[model samples]
Target: MPTALITGATAGIGAAFARRLAADGFSLVLVSRDETRLAEAAERLKQKYGVAVDVLPADLATDDGLERVEARLREGVDCLVNNAGFGHPGHFLEVPLEDEVRMLKVHCEAVLRFTLAALPGMRARGRGAVINVASVAAFFTRGTYSASKAWVVNFSESTAAEVGDPKIRIMALCPGFVRTEFHQRASMDVSGIPGFLWLQADAVVNEAMRDLALGRTVSIPDPRYKAIVAVGRLIPRGLTHRISAMIGRK
Candidate 1:
């Protein structure tokens, strides 16, 4: 069975990926900050899917954590999912700089380092894929969160071009608002967000897997989100920014 390493594997989209991939017969290495939660998640996956699971507890926000994960990536896995991330409840100016920096570390630096570490082994084997979990926020401006994700999209595309190997697939997954711990953890009020805007984690993962198989470098899971992103690109920047600002407000 192919091996896969996933960050933030204890919850939300990360957990969805774990379940989906395990069912598909992939040996899993689950990375998260909480050891107890990681162990619980791994145990559940093993019992449910009958697949081997490794729980790797590490805070991707720290250099030590990044190094540990990078080392594992260098050891080789058929697939890597950089899905660990969080959001701030406050607007940009109101949020602390330390929090913003931490977000960058997890969203940008860890993604960069982990992908870099994984590619060499994949290049040698000539077959592997890395899915960078970005957000539809990447297409619009929602403060540091969107900015970091936009970097992810650009970085994924640019890296794909540079790698120039069809076998070494690199893709950015841009999912819209999914019902996850994300909003709750960030304490963001979602009353203004329409019901139709919400997405299921499993559905998003299913589309992402299909898109990856089809060799799509960028996977925007939902049709609604795909259209939204398309239209977002067509609109003027000032208008889009204004809309993003409004959406970010509680």
Candidate 2:
């Protein structure tokens, strides 16, 4: 079976990807900061799907952690899911500078390092895939969270083009308001978000897998989000920023 490495694999979109890939017969390497949770997630996937699961506990915010994961990626895996990320609780200006930098490390630098480490092995083997988990927030002007994710989307598209190998797929997975621990972890009050705006993690993963198979460089899971992004692009930047900020406010 092909192996897939997923960072932030203990919850949310990362966990969903773990379940989907394991069900599809991919052996898994799950990376997370929580060793206990990582072990638990690994056991659950292994038991449910009868697939091999390895847990790597690493904080992507630090150099030591990124190096550990990068070392593993260099060893080669058929797929890499760059899903580890978090959000700040308040506006960008209110948040600490260190926290902002940490977010960039996990969302930008780690993705760059992991993809670089993984691609050479994939190139040698003549096949592999990388899915960077960005957010629909990437299309808006929410804050650093959106800014970092925007970088992810751009990076994925550019890297995919530079690689220029149809067999080696690199794609961005963007989901809107996923019903996961993400909001809770970020300490965001989602009460203002409409019920219809929420999306299940499994559903997002299913569509992401489909898009990857279909050779799409970017996968926006739902038609609702696809339309939102389309319309957001058509509108004025100032209007879009105001709307986005209003919706994201507590």
Candidate 3:
């Protein structure tokens, strides 16, 4: 069976992906910062799916942490899911410099490094898939979070273009307001939003995986979100920024 390496596999979309892939008969290597949770997740998946599961605990924000994951990537995994990321809510100026730097490391540097490290082996094999968990926030200039997601989007698109003829597939999965620990962990205020507007984690992961299998370069999970992105492109940048700022306050 093919093996999949997934970061942030302890919770949210990452965890959902783990379950889905396990059910599809893939063995797994799960990466996350929480050792206990990681072990628990791995154990559950292994027991539930009868597939081998390995837990790798590392903070993608730190160099040592990223190096640990990179070392594993060199082992020639078949699929890589760069799903580790988090966000902090506030005006850019109000957010601490350290937090922003850490976000950059986790959301940007770690992703780029892992993809780079894994690409050589994937290219050599001529058959592999990479999924970067981005966000519909990439369509808006909400904050540094959205900016980082935009980077993921462009990176995946560029990679697809660079290796279009090869079987190496790179895709960005962009889902809006996923029903996960994301809001609570980020301390983001979502008081005004209705619960129905949020997409479930499993649904998002399922759609993304389907799209990846179909060789789509980018997959936005919700139809509403796809419409939002479509409308966003037609609007002027200034208007988009203003709308984003308004939503950020809610």
Candidate 4:
């Protein structure tokens, strides 16, 4: 079976990827900060899917952690999911400079380093894939988080074009308001987001997998979100940012 390494594999989209890939018969290397949580999640996947699961406990924000994960990537995995990320709770001015930099470290630097580490092996092998989990916020003006994710989307697209390999794939998965620990962990209130706009994590992953298999470079899961992005693109960016700010302030 092919092997897959997923960063931030403890929960949300990363955990969902672990489950899906395991069910698809891929051996898994799960990377996350919490050793206990990684072990527990690995056990669960091993039991459920009978797929081999390895845990790599590392914080993506630091040098030591990034180096450890980078070394693993060089060893060669057929798939890499750069899904580890977090969000700040308040306005840009309210959040500390250190916190902003940490977000960049995880969302941008880690993704860039890990992708670069993994791709050479993949290119040599003539087949592999990388999925970077960005957010729909990437299209908007949501401060550092969106800016970092925007980088992810552009990087994924450019890399895919540069590689120009039918077998080696790079894609960005952008989901809108999925029901994960994402907002809870970020301590953001989601009450103002409409019920219809919310998405389920499992469904989002399913769509993503389908898109990847179809060789799509960017996968935006739901039709509602697809429409939103299309509309967001058509309108003036200032208007989109204002509307996004109003919703986010709630």
Ranking, lDDT, top scorer first: 1, 2, 4, 3
Write model 3 residue lDDT over 155-188, tens digit each, in one string: 9999889878458889999998887888778887
Question: Model 4: clashing residue pairs?
Answer: none
Estimate the lDDT of model 4: 0.93
**Higher-lDDT candidate of 1 and 4:** 1
lDDT of each: 0.95, 0.94, 0.89, 0.93
TM-score of 3: 0.96
Residues 1-250 of candidate 4 have per-residue lDDT tens digits of 9999999999988999999999999999999999999999999999999999999999999999999999999999999999999887778888899999999999999999999999999999999999999989888888898999999999999999999997998999999998888888888888888899988888999999999999999999999999988999999988987887765552
Model 2 alpha-carbon miss at residue 4, Å: 0.3
TM-score of decoy 2 = 0.99
- Model 3: weakest 10-residue lDDT segment is 241-250
Q: Candidate 1 — which residues are off by over 4 angstroms?
A: none
**Greater-lDDT candidate between 3 and 4:** 4
Candidate 2 lDDT by residue in tens digits, 1-250: 9999999999999999999999999999999999899989998998999999998899999999999999999999999999999987777789999999999999999999999999999999999999999999899998889999999999999999999999999999999999888778878888999999899999999999999999999999999999999999999999998897776554
Residue 66 local lDDT, model 3: 97
Please write out the lDDT profile of model 1 over residues 28-90, one tens digit for every residue: 999999999999999999999999999888999999999999999999999999999999986
Could you report the Cα RMSD, in angstroms, for every candidate shown? 0.8, 0.7, 1.2, 0.9
Per lDDT, the best of the predicted structures is: 1
